[model samples]
Target: MTSQNSRQTLIIPALGGLYARLNDGVETLLRVIAGGFLAVHGSGKIVDPFGASEMVEGLGFYPGAFWSPLLAATEFFGGILIALGLLTRPAAFAGMIVLLVTVWFHWVTMGQGFSGAEKSLLWAAALAFFVVRGGNRHSIDARLGKAF
Candidate 1:
């Protein structure tokens, strides 16, 4: 049987063997860290789910009462789902949307430009990655033999 390393080497004549072994672990690490931080960041907001009503309303998401709780849940619960690798794609997509809004808020609303929105842009990129990759083999989605 061809081992994973050997297959990797065949696919890429150099470096693949060395790096392929770490792919899943690194992906998992990134996912966990991103999701964990997102959850923590949203923890305070989730505590008072309606607190961001005015803020979301400012963003044009009518009915601040509805958007506020949704924003909180998307950050907190979606973060948990991402971290657990359950429904990873949808969760990451939600995160990406939130990050995109932050990017807009910082760059356009606050007029901070790239300097202020850089972090949110980076986060959006990471979540975008997860949205496309849909978790690695070590994820719950993989174990369940399905992903979305």
Candidate 2:
């Protein structure tokens, strides 16, 4: 092969490999940021688990006394699990459900329109991505040889 062709062949493969690593790194970063934010945001709910009883009941979840702690645990602990890429898909799936509910609550219940529901919509999309993609090579799921 000519010098230029040889260089092209080498460079192309090198770039492909770099791109794969970069994609994995970006995925890991997204997981960490999303999960960490959920954990921190849920911290207040954990402290006063029953404080949301009225709001949750207003959302028609019913018996907020029962679901309050469950919501708190799902966000806080599930966020930790997702951040670690341990049972990531399940955690993300659960988070997605919570976010969807928030979307409905903000848009329909509060009549806040797209602007109010936008954050929950974005979070739901992120969680949905994780639900589909699971954890990448840099994740604990990958290390454990688990698909989900």
lDDT of 2 by residue, 1-148 (tens): 3356445655457575666557778889999888889888788888988888888899998899988887898898888887888899999999999999999999999999899999999999998999998977777899999876
- In terms of TM-score, how similar is model 2 to the real structure? 0.86
Question: Per-residue alpha-carbon lDDT of model 1 for 59-147, expressed as tens digits?
Answer: 88989999999999999999988998999999999999999999999999999999999999999999999999998887899999999
Each model's total of backbone clashes: 0, 0
Error of 2 at 37 (Å): 0.6
lDDT of 1: 0.91
Error of 1 at 29 (Å): 0.5
Off by over 4 Å in 1: 1-15
Per-model TM values vs. the true structure: 0.89, 0.86
Candidates' RMSD to native: 3.6, 5.9
